[model samples]
Target: MSRRWLLCLALLPCAAQDVIQDWIREIEQSGGGQVLIARAGYDAEANEIRLAPGTTRPELFAEYLHQLAFVRELMAAQALTVSRQTPEEGPLHLILINTARIAGRRDVEEAVIGHELGHAWLRTLGYPAVAAGNSVANCLAIHATDAVQHILIRKELRRRGIDAETPWIATLNDALDQWKVRPLPAALTPCERIQTASQWVDVRLGLDEARWPRITGYEAQLKTRYPDIEQAVSGLAAYLAGQDVAEKEVNRRALLEAVRRLRALAPPTTPLKTNQ
Candidate 1:
C-alpha cells in the first residue's frame, strides 16, 4: 500500500481500518489490482474528476473508508474517488461519493456510498450501458438507467441491514417542502425535467411503500408538480416493478427498456449543450 493509503487507514477507527485492509487484501488476492483512493471532485462544467480543495486528503480518505467498511461488496471496485461535489457518478468500477452531500452524517454517508457501490456492483455484473453523444442525452441516459438499478440497489442494501430508505425519504420530503414554498417554474428544460423526475423515480422505486406508506403521497405530489414527465416516470416505474427477479438477464433487459423509455421523454431536437 502507498503512504497515503496507510495514512488513510490510520485515520479510521481500528475496526474499520482492519475491515478495509481485509477487503483490500481479498481484492489483491483475487487479482483485482491494488485499491486506489483519492479525494477528488467532479467539475460538472468540464465533465471530469479532479482533486478538490477544502478538506484535507487524510480526512477525506478516512471518511470514505469509514463508510466503505459497511459495504463489503463495494470492494469489487479497484478504485474509489470521494468527492465533495453533488450528484455522484460511478463509471464501471470507479465509484465517486459526494461527501458534500453527506456532510459528516454517518447514516447518510453509508446509504449514499452503498447506493453508489451498488452501481459499481452492477457494472461488474455486465449491466447494460446507456449510450448518448451529448451531455443532455447522456444525462437522460444516466437517469433512465438508474431508474432500474435503484431497485436492485435498494434490495441489496436491505439484505445487508442498511437503512437506505430513510435518507432518501428525508431528502425527497425536504425538496418537496422547499419546492412548495417557492414553486417550480411553469416550464422546465428537458435536462431539468429528466433530473427532477429521475430523483423522484429513484425514491419511489427504492422506498418500501409497505413500510413507508406515505411514499404514495409523495408520488402523487411529484406527479402533480411535473405533469410533463409523468408518463415517462410512470412507465419506467411500471417496467421496473415487474423486474422482481434479480438475475443478470432480467436486470439487463429492464435497463434497456428503462433507458429507452427515458430517452423517449426528451425531444430529438434537444441541443448538445453541456450539463450545468
Candidate 2:
C-alpha cells in the first residue's frame, strides 16, 4: 500500500509535465515551426515592468509568451504579417505592451491589450471599419475583455452610492483586478451568466442601448447557440445607449429567463476525471 501510494504521488508531477508538453506540442503544430517570439529591445517603459529576477516563476513568462505565440498563430492562420515601416494592412505589430504605470496590474494590461487585439482580428475578418471611440468600438472593447471588468467596476461604484458616470482610475484598477479573478458559477447558463456578470457596466455606462446594435451585429459571427440570451442582453446594451433604462430592465429580465432555460437544458459541471 505504501509503495502504491508513493507511485501515485510520483505520477502526479509526470502528469502535469505531460500536460505542459502536450500544450507546447500543440503550439508547435499550430505555428508550423515559423513562430518566433523574443524579448527584443525594451523601451524605458518596458524596462519598468519589474517582475523580480530569478524569484519570479518562469511559468508566468511562459504563459505570456504562449499568448503572444497564439496571436502570431492567428495571423499565420489568416496568412498575414506585421508590416513595420510599410503601410500594408495585414497582421498587427507584435507588441509586448509595457508601460510603467501599467505595472502590478495584470488584468488591465490583459483587458486593454486584449481589446486592441480583438480590433486586429476584426479587421482581418473584414467588417465596416469604425473608429475606436465610436459606440461600436467601445462595445468591441468591452466584449474583448468579456464585459467582466466593466460590470465589476459599475457594481463597486453603485454599491458605494457613487455615480457611475464619474471617471475614477482607482476604481477602474480595482475593477480590473476583480474581473481577472472572478469565476462564473457552473450553475448559471452562459448567456445569463455573461449578462448577470455584465449587469453593472450595462446599467452604469448605458451600454445596453448605446452598444446593443453593435453587440447584436456580433452574434452572426459567434459559433455558439446562445443567440437568444446574447440578443436579449444586446438589446439591453442598445437601450443603455439610448438611455432607455426601462427597456434595458425589460431586456435584462428576458435575458435572465433565457439563461434559466439554458441551465435547465444543461447542468453546468466539470467532467469526471479518468485514470488512463
What are the lDDT scores of the predictions, listed in order?
0.55, 0.33
TM-score of each: 0.67, 0.24
- Give the Å error, residue 133, model 1: 4.1
| Steric overlap count per candidate | 0, 13
Candidate 1: deviation at residue 235, Å? 1.7
TM-score of decoy 1:
0.67
Candidate 1: regions farther than 4 A off: 1-92, 131-133, 208-210, 268-276
lDDT of 2 by residue, 96-170 (tens): 333333443433333333333332332232321211122222223223232322333344334433343332334
